[model samples]
Target: MSSILAHNLHLEFDFSYTSFPLVSLSIAFGVWLVWKTWKLITISRASLPLPPGPVPLPIIGNLHQMSVTDQSSTFLQWQEIFGDLVYVNIFGTPTLILNSYEDAKELLGVRSQIYSDRPRLSVAGELVGWNRSLVLGKFGERHRTMRRLLARSIGGKHAQSFRLHEEFAICTFLLNLLEKPRDLKLLLSQLTGSVVLDVAYGHQVKSGHDQLIFWFRRIVQDFYDATAVGSIIVDMIPALTYLHSYIPFTSFKKTVATWRAHLTETIEHPFSRVKEQLRNGIARTSYVAQHLSEGPLDFETEDALKYSSFNLYAGGMETLAVALSTFFFVVTKYPAIQQRAQQEIDNVTEGKRLPTSNDRERLPFVEAVMLEVLRWSPITPTSLPHRLEVEDIYKGYRIPQGAVVYSHPWAMSRDKRSYTSPHEFRPDRFLETPKEPDPRLFAFGFGRRICPGKHIADDTLFLAIALTLATCNVTKRVNEAGDLIEPIPQYTMGVVAHMAEFDFEITSRSDDAIQMLTAAHTQLGE
Candidate 1:
């Protein structure tokens, strides 16, 4: 039967070379087609106005070229290779990494409006409705309102009103660290959380293990981690979202829905509670209550409540935590810096009080330490993504619209053009007369999206560090093997950066230290 089938198939074919020539020609044409495509790509490359970069392959582009080493270091290395302004293709999307301070200033500063937009985080911002979050919103009316409200609530002059809370929060943090030295990270996170929560929702978290605080932070961390990670199959190849539910693997729809539901619940439940509390003749001066009463403004909508809460969670908490972590790591490593700051505090307040916002100007070292802490750890190295709203013509080249602009603080902070010893931790850099560290402003970010919580962050850090350093000395904890183990100064990756945890032992300082800190703490409240 098989032989009969082969015989019949052969009978259908003509064995003449004249007829076979057509098939040969077809094969040759296919090879010629591929060759022509290759040539076209090589020639087209010259015509395209490409930014400075290594050549990229078809489809994926330079996505695979990105190395996920320590994000800052990897970016620095890329800058060295591709020049200050490098273009890398991120899944066919053009990404601009500005390694120079001038380039960042030019793009994000001079071309402010054109480069101030954000990439569409459809899943987190749209799906979870995080557009209401201040940091995620597109540049427009809503963004202006959100930023203005935040600045009013937690920015400059308004932060002064919260000095009492800052004093209490720092004192609480110092006392906890002195008593239970092992739980440093937990205590620091909660201290910041308590202040922001009180500021936003009028809720006071007494401990790091508070259920509400724990759940809120957990959800926030999950959301941020998800936001940072790229799900290219769905993002680059978006049709996967419409896959049939009958298929066993439909996790994308479920995961996104579940996250959005979680966010909605987390954000809305607290607003209701605050409202209920307000109705009982217990009016609290929180951002949430203020917004609720004010109702809709030009920028305020019902969705604003949830997004504002998200901003409170993201902007308010992490900056404080990372700053404290940087302080701890620096103090543990450079005991001299800590001692110098302590001496300055002692001289100003006579070791009888902790430093306050009022004393921030007097204690130059305290201010310096805060600056150095931000510079040393340098959180959010890449800052946040900025999108080009219009084509930017700079340096005789055109930066086309739709480019993803990265304002790399990592590179900027370490630029030789900025600091003398950019890598080393030097508090004195801030004290120099002719030129102090040009404000170390990169840590917070730039333009309209610049962190509104910066003033609060500064106050919180100074008070916390001053109180902690004045009262107790941070040294390495002894391991079970009797060797002192210090925190390895490594960074965690993401849009935000943090010091990796290491066990350190905090010992109570002399009686004078405690007395001075207490006095300073008292002065802070006044």
Candidate 2:
């Protein structure tokens, strides 16, 4: 009996040991199967096609191909090579350029929920303190609040109240042109600055060298220069932003610091003055004074108000200045077009009065010319980089979260599908096909982030163009040797795309025109 029990126990032990090895092998095989499945899924995701683009280099990606001053033109060339949607990598950042209107409208407009966010501009927005400014603010509750306030203050009918400011400013500019034709660009800049100051802070800019104008102009110019693509290396290589403090005598850092200080002052100075005016019962109909009059505001609300006001001041002044300057440059080059515009203005107003907003609808040709000028040279070509807030697939390609997207208005303006003979500056194109999309739609921008000041911009530009053409004959500057030195149609490399400083002759078209401008300026008490 003892021998039989020992044999049975030994058999039980042998069976238990063999089952343990089989169990271990089965467990190992299960883990391997799971891992293989996971890896295949990962590979499938990685293999999803990205948008067509030029192959990037190892580390720098496509940074070498970008130009700091002329990124729009460069992107346009790439659009031709890679079709409408071109993907590029700047360092590790995936940049998607929307070259066509349909693509831009689809991504930035139709699906704005995912594409409304602004790119994190480490150099321009953060370092320069423009993140507080509405133009560069992130997509959030703060942005929404500021945008709503801005829309209420400067949009639609509220924009029309400021038309008097524009009319007076343009009339003053006309007189300045008569006295100092060579200073046409300077006069236009001062006029825009004056109008913006009055609208934003109720402060009249009395001189070209007004301290406020000078500081704001410097701030705007430097901000554009500092924030421009490829302007600061740290923007492309984000790690370097933290390292900036460790390096001694960093010029860019110093510049940014100075800019931040100036920017703060730009926002606070006029606002404080307006508030003081409100407190003293001498407040005017300025944006700040009007808001302050509503009652005391909390810190956050007040802060939003301050930055929103700065947005109006900066955006209104700089963009209008650039657009009006571009008009002068383009019309000076194309005399026949200028003559045609002047004829239209003459027929509309009969040289008895300066052009006003009431005349805008009747002056379709004049409006078309304004549209053409905007299309010919879009002020903000890429319309400030937008960021994808979530992962999205567009046209069978994955657009990962945080990818920088650009709506290339410059390229869209020259689209053959949209405009016939797109490169040529033809105003009649708008009149030809009522169905054809106005370039202004793309020029202003797309989606929820379209320039909030578009109404003000449109009104200001129209008045400037009509009144200037009505009163003045812009011709090439004649040298002492009696030769007409035609101004070169060149543009500066910046966010606003200003026409390069060029010489032109500005003379009153007729005595009646000068009388009309003088009478209008006198009526406005300027």
Candidate 3:
């Protein structure tokens, strides 16, 4: 019955040539329209302008515009010209500079999974074998394993366990300042190196002549030499790293080989010491000792232990010293700030005793001063480069995969948007109503790669600040002619920025402070 109805209604197909022309034209037009739309979208995404950067020159890219010595000021100028995110090409490698908090927070913090990888340092990391250490290690299982090991050893809650190490070291530091105050930098290095070595390995540092300290000094210098900007040709041309043995440049090759050897010795020295301590049944509580206390580990795990342990302390030592040095420099210049800090410590200790870790909560002003120093001159002015895992887009900008990224703590510290009177050294900003955000967040870093030793560094810095203020008065130095030697706030540029040497007088605040310092030193029994 349906067939009969269709037959009556005459539902006919339009397959004739006359109908084909219009149908074909319509289909072709629709296909063409679709192709055009897709082409526009693809072109837009591919050419998203790369976050607004200076025009790069051929081959050299933006390297000509960059001052290898002072990337901080250069990046600051770029931030002024092109907002927060500035992209540049270094040689053939793509790089993105993040000068603002929000941009860094979003990329390095919120989206860390894709932004947590460190850049490949050919000469330093590969040729000199520094890549095994957690700082320059590639992002992968090894890094994760190291992070877990570090977290268990000296992270957040566990950091309090090392209070004795910090206290003992600081006390020694105070005595050194009293006995040999002229070499402040050397004293500080000893202080930091001792504390870190004692905590990271079970190695107790001898005052001035510990072999481990010697190795540390040598290795850190080697690190600087191997990683110096544009100094090693291999870093820019990675392929040269393979030709080290055959390279005609004997001096460079020999230098790199020596650096590699020093790094190995430095990493192994403390680890061997810890093992020896364990074997002799006199192991001190430390990251290495604690791990070794567990049943024996396989080569991979033990290797991870050795390298991660070194990174744990070695990474913090120089940076902590720099932060403390900056603290002294600031106080020497602004005696009022130092006095205020002393007053705060006195309020906590009542001038009857040396300030201890327990007094940390009670000494807010001291904490503020530490924070201010970090903000004034971030130990690491530039964040270690983080390479992107995949190509991405942000704010209509296309960032290519493998584009190494660097966040500027120096820029963030001086950002008017986040700080008021950014140039001023105001500790009150951290304490006053509607307080400023703690600089530690960005200063330490952001995301998965944020400093694992941050907690320990914080605890260590606060104690050093508190103890020094409570016991000593840092003042301007006088020349041979008895003229005032004013300090100028200046810093050296490198991976760890250090305050330039300044003459300052550090002496006991009072007879009581001297007695207390004496008592603490005696308790050390050194």
Candidate 4:
């Protein structure tokens, strides 16, 4: 009875002392919370103050408005509505689309320092473990070092050195194409895969169904499957990462392990063999061997084994291969463009020899055709996502820290503000332009994170496009019912967008084509 009475008395005393103080503190905290929430809401609502777009919902934001999986359609839709500059969001992550050359040059080109950082993809980094991915890595010292190493080894003047092997591979591929015209896909894949493998690892990949070729295809398919949007939902909701694997919702642990296992395996074997060969005094002047000889400095053994090899396989195969695939589509659809390109090639080379990298400057029309091809079918439509590390202003808008910054190459390429007939494939736009904008470099990317293997990709593309035009006419065949049939423009979506696989028939333009190809392959050892 005494204890109960004391407790009641203590409670009465405590209430008398704390009631007013508690109410005051509550009022102060409530006001602070309201102010902070309003500030966040205002900042979140703020954009670069460009064109209008669908307002985003708080938290999830505009992810619902845009296509997260296949952003091309979203980009296209925004272009129609938002004009040159459009803004969207993904879970409160700001995605600014530069829809014109003016916008691309202004934001991605002019203000490059502010625009160069990559968005932090928690899922992509931790789940699939692309933390070391050269293309997807953040803009910083590591990106610079990797890019510098790659540029010295592959891009710029050093890039020209790989053309010998590249041209040789092209000739061999042409011979195989002539022999098996039905398997155009296989021919193109082998042609590109061989060059990338040879240059990156010094492995001589063959024309059809080789081990290296098989593994290359397997790895690319796996990587694509793993990185496809929503492949890892834990990437978006990071708190879920800490959940117990025994729980039904936990999937990241399994997904991450699978991706790491495959990625590590592909990277390690080639590096080990390359290292072994270098130690044996039989040094091949390949990218991996070059790094290996320097002995674990800029590129650690694990990095050499994993990241570098992955970059070559991923960047080299997907971007170049998709571009070529789309080129095939464009050539078949627009024969006039093909004929014009071929005519220029014939006028310059006089039909005497295959087009070489040296002949690039002379064949302006052909170069224009390549440019149009890249523009029409942007391999990486949305050039990798960027992040703002520091809080700054873009065109008088307070762009808060950790906002996602995107460089929309697809949007920019198709913008009516830049190209007159942005919808159509007209190579003459590049040739007849009052000012010939540099299209080749932009197709790669901007600033420090620009593609390292861009030169090799370009040279290979030049050789392939020229030779394919030189050797055969790519045309859509009439169906069994005598109707003109066109291959559907279906795309596989990711950070790198690729055209769906389709077949096309090829026939030699002249008997001279076969002879010229034969002579070239005979002289050029594959």
Top model number, TM-score: 3
| TM-scores of all predicted structures | 0.85, 0.88, 0.90, 0.84
lDDT digits (tens) for residues 166-204 of candidate 3? 888898898888888888999899989988888898567
lDDT-best of 1 and 3: 3
| TM-score, model 2 to reference | 0.88
Q: Rank the candidates by TM-score, best first.
A: 3, 2, 1, 4
Which sections of candidate 3 miss by over 4 Å?
1-44, 230-232, 244-251, 524-526
How does each model score on lDDT?
A: 0.74, 0.84, 0.86, 0.74
lDDT tens string, model 1, 44-109?
A: 554557578767889988777775535566678778887788877877788888887788877787
Candidate 1 has its poorest 10 consecutive residues by lDDT at 225-234
Measured on C-alpha atoms, candidate 4 has an lDDT of 0.74
Q: After aligning candidate 4 to the native by TM-score, how far in Å is the CA of 106 from where it should be?
A: 3.7
Task: Judge candidate 1 at residue 326 and give its lDDT.
Answer: 83
RMSD of each: 15.7, 7.9, 5.3, 11.2
Give the poorly placed runs of model 2, Cα more than 4 Å off. 1-46, 228-231, 236-251
> Pick by lDDT: which candidate is best?
3
- Which ranges in model 4 have alpha carbons more than 4 Å from their true place? 1-52, 294-306, 433-436, 486-490, 501-503
